[model samples]
Target: MDMSVTFGDDSVAAAAAEAARKLAEEGVPRALADGDATLWGGEAESEAAIRLGWLSLPITSRELLPEIGKLVERVRAESLEHVVLAGMGGSSLAPEVICASADVPLTVLDTTDPGQVRRALADRLDRTVVVVSSKSGSTVETDSHRRIYEKAFRDAGIDPADRIVVVTDPGSPLEQSAIEAGYTVILADPNVGGRYSALTAFGLVPSALAGADVTRLLDDAAQAREQLGADDEPGLLLGTAIGSAAASGRDKLLLDDSLSDINGLPDWIEQLIAESTGKQGRGVLPVAGSEPNEAGDELVAGIDTEGDIEVHAPLGAQFLIWEYATAVAGRLLGINPFDQPNVAESKENTTRILGEAGDGPLPTGTPALVDGPVEVYGDLPPHAKDLSDVLTAVLQDIPDRGYLAILAYLDREAAFDVPVPPEASFETITDIWAAHDPASLQGLLAIRTDRPVTFGWGPRYLHSTGQYHKGGPQNGVFLQITGAVTDDLDVPGKPYTLGRLQLAQALGDLDALRQRGRPAVRLHLTDREAGVRHLLAAAREV
Candidate 1:
């Protein structure tokens, strides 16, 4: 599954080899020149990464299962139809994963999307209980969302005090909010990052809703922790591998196919990897959940092209296996994975984005152009029989670095054989949201377009585009394509069919564009991503 390419003078082979060497040595407990083994940084950059991997091991006791069970029961007993977890990053994502995997109907709002908040409140509010989740209780997003929920309840005529819940450290700001609100507070175990919090309240929300065999989950987690933490077992080996990799200037990229199954996990992994290892201008990347995606290739190209050391962790990978691999890698590289140094970027971005509005709206500056525009539209005039020819023609016509956001709405069966624009080639494409791996994808698109162009799916784009596209300049040229899926799932009682719903959303978004006095063109396709690619090729031909 490993491929090598010779791009100019960049020798990825050597870079990759050195990274591998670092991963190999990180685990051995070595005395430093300063006479400290565990006291100072290790050999591998992945050392810290490997170290962080151990936290996933579940080492809790059977004795604690009952406490968790009772907590679940209490949530049910409170006549709460839905629990709103209000934490950011790791604290909130684990629970969201549980919900998605169990396919529960309960709503979990993990983002600060006003539209999402509005939907949650409109649907739940009086009927559902809200869980405000924040481990530190000081996460700005968590607090901001909490305020949103508070205002929502107040507006809905519900006593804000009675409608909300808080989950956080015992004395955190979130806990204070819960106290002042007169609602239930779930005190999560300290020492766990928001991502690791999944084992705690992070896992509880969905467990309570979907009746997940959390007892079994906890058992698995506990087993992972116990087995990995052992002094001489795979834990040591894995830790060594991680340490080695980090020291050698090689980073870790966690590739999990279970990403879609575990909703919100990709984001959690990003935060964990960024915060845990990105200290002192170095760190391992935990890349998860870009399965069956076009974005994957672009991501790999970015790394392999630049010769960034990487480790791809597949779905359902053994916890110990990864631990040992990373540990050994870190030892070879020389760094710590336990500390978060560059975590300020996210906060800074958020602050800047929020500040730009200054009580007005998010400023939409010029969009970054990385992925040159590929004519990924499926529906096109001047149709041709040979798709390849069409694709070549379409690609030749567009700007070199534009991203064509495709939307065919076509079902899987009907869209299997669609042709891709020549420029539409990607190193990877995940089934999940492409935006989650913002840094990786952004890097890829940057390289492709010599600018940054992004592809966004529906529902999510509606929330994110308002400030950027409308408030900002016409940096992004939206394709706004639509198509029909072969088979549609019809849920009874819904106002519109899913197909119609897609069209409506597209229209609504286009209307938003028009309101901004922006110009957008819509292309109708027979398939979603597939036909869009096909049409992109066709457009190039013209």
Candidate 2:
């Protein structure tokens, strides 16, 4: 194996060891390797049976190397060097991590924000080759992206067939559509679920197209596959640690990637672990935030960052071990790890809202406090006068052992970052420099609370941690920040604009959470730039 695993605190080591012993006695590793369906019980057996195809991918995926190589060359030959991956969840996250770790640039469109979507369409359109990847073949965001891209290509007088590549299951709706449209389609392994498809065509197609050495990645994972399922191996040990930690009341897994050689790995791990095990009203919250909290209920884990356990590995092996570990953790938690049952509620809600909304402005709740560019839309304390008080009221609702999720439904990617808070005091230069990062919002607020705080971008996170928020433990308090879209873009073939779609998705998730009886508040930014600045300043006040 090309991975090295080192255990940190001995606090959960005993429980972890016991978990491993139980797994070994039950032959869990061997059973997983052999594609046993009953490992997660009868309820999950059907899903597990088909989902276990990922177990064979390190070996089977090698067959795709030549095809991927030939395709990459063909794209190059056609002068379409720019690669845009239109996907969500597993389809986009895995490749984003893979390409970033390999120091390659692959444009990923996993969002419905109009500004963000517009930016991708405007960048190098003539040289672009879009890889439309969707495990379900009917993901709304993916379908919308494909439609817009097709229109863009046609408008530029280019054949969509020459620039569009579809990666999906063999018999999926997307596969059929690609065939009918005369576009190239790459079939993914039918047995592998979306989250577990890092080694499948979904992860490779766009990555390889963007100039990553995917053949070498397969070689690395193949080497690790032979021994990972063993009882004493790194994969099993790591899974045992995770299961034991969560079961022992340390449910928040703070993923510290500050010192990692792999760029943007925590986000990928967040979805894999969160979606896989975050169900049955029990789950581990993967905190991919800027800093780990001082709360004792949190288990600080790391990629190359130091914590309760540190993992160091090649990108390919990292994917394999984490998948294996997540499965094992699911067993210890007594939940079916392969299924995301609550993920569809928001999607369904969005569809219904869009159907009934027509051209009307989406409804909004009565505002509790309206301060300049920011509007507080949810219930806050009676004494909450200013924006800072509203922010404090939202954070105050976080229970003793609960988490706070900051959901920003705006084009945060397109937003620029200003300097650090003037009143903040830092001992290290690194901390000062890190404040300028656009992904630093949750971090600044994270410093305000001793509890675990997580941040997710709009619509994109709907496919990620949105599952856990509704299905996992009911101890999370949500702070949903939505923006009034200043520059809106229309969907080429739909009645709704991208901004409208983004707001609807946010409302959908918020409604879903409220239906679950979770405490939440909505804060609308009438002016994004000023609203964000005010929010950050309010964070300091909080």
Candidate 3:
């Protein structure tokens, strides 16, 4: 692994070294290895469930190396052309990362957007194997994706059982469903939590299906495992840097990867560090996917692979390294890295709002479209004019040590009712929209404000950064942008439409933020594309 670190100040480095020594003396690493939850200031029984599962992933992955190889061989024998993983958060991120280097065509459906869902099912339903993955097997998004695809497969005169695979804990509802439906079922370890299951079946099976070199990946992970107990282990050193930096007033973590071939790795790390440690009024803010030159109270780390090695080696190494570093960071932050307590609030709220849905008009407000490109909605303070004015108003309330969080409830891609032409595949559409729109919004916000700007897509962020916004330090100024869902789809076993469900989640989170007394603004746009354009224009004006 070709990894290096540099601190903005010598004092920061000295403090990190001291902290690493103290942590070693206190046996933090050993406690983590032994599955002791004592380092976290909480009842042991309460935190015990999440501690041990991730601790053994590196070793377990190595043990399962042969099994992974056999599975890949079986997949090849079956002549499966594509694999679509229907999962969210932990269940999805690792597969997406591994598939970046995959030879087999793999698509991960983590969004409930009807258009994206349709695109995933448009052409590949025949020779494609759908992997329905959820640790608990009951995630709404995962189950919903499975239901939609199953219906599509059946309608197309295909036997869904022959083309479906289930990845979940034994006896999970999804596992039982898969068994009853005669689908291939691969039971993940029951103890491993979703976010920490990168090295477990949740990640490895997909890696194999994608035709990745699982043996080499496991070899790299095994190397990372060997460094866990050493005093100067790379994982520990990085963790110490993160822990000490946050403790010394540099809580904003700027993570960048120079490896162009690997995408979404930073997003995975963002969830791991943010959701795990962002609680009890202190957390580390991971800034990824965007570049901000101003490093005020921020720790910047660049992750690069050695030029001589294959991408999978260092990529696999990163999985173990970050997992261990985050555990160390959790110990230093006095929190349990395994459990996400606040993640359920938005879910429950969304369910309640859906249950209460009736003929009532959707909860939406008009934005004030003044000289700016986008309109402002919700409570826009007293004198805000356009979306930019609303952002400027929100900026005024940011504390000296605070950051800006741009939360978008807009669909990641435009919705389509008809099947896309074979000439223009899902990948083509993604490539078209890849460079424009919200991709530049982060840089624009960073250049406009001194405070660090973090961007998160809706409902998805509800599972990732939403935990931090509510449970972490109240040093965030939230600007939530929501737009009209023109083509809505129904979620199976739910009372509301997918569009309505998304709206409910957005409203639920916005309400939750306000209830916490955090400074937040909601902007409702009539047009999604225009809304983004106006948002960028507003950001530039600010």
Per-residue error at 281 for model 3, in Å? 0.9
Q: Considering every candidate listed, which one attains the maximal lDDT?
A: 2
In model 2, which runs have C-alpha deviations exceeding 4 angstroms? 416-438
RMSD of each: 12.4, 3.1, 4.1
What candidate 3 gets wrong by more than 4 Å, as runs, is: 1-9, 42-46, 62-71, 101-104, 259-261, 305-313, 365-375, 413-436
TM-score of each: 0.54, 0.95, 0.89
What are the per-residue Cα lDDT tens digits for candidate 3 across 24-142?
Answer: 89887766666676666665346655556766676775766676677667767877778888888888878888777554457878776665676677756677778888888888878
TM-score of 2: 0.95
Q: lDDT winner between 1 and 2, please give it.
A: 2
Deviating ranges (above 4 Å) for candidate 1: 1-67, 229-270, 289-332, 345-542
Question: By summed lDDT, which 10 consecutive residues of candidate 1 come out lowest?
Answer: 365-374
lDDT by residue for model 2 (1-542), tens:
44766777886667778888998898998887678889888999988988989888989988888888889989999888789999999999999999999998999999888878888899899999999999879998999899989999999999999999999998889988899999988899999999999999999999999999888888888877888667777778889899998888998998888888788888999999888888889999999865766677888878876888888788888888888889989988999999999999999999888888887878676788898888988778889999889778877888899989988887755543335566767644346444433345687777777888898987888788988999999899999989888888778878988888888998899889999999988889898777777777777788
lDDT of 2 at 284: 93
How displaced is residue 265 in candidate 1, in Å?
Answer: 5.4
The candidate, 1 or 3, that scores higher on TM-score is 3
In model 3, which range of ten residues has the least summed lDDT?
304-313
Cα lDDT for residue 461, candidate 1:
36
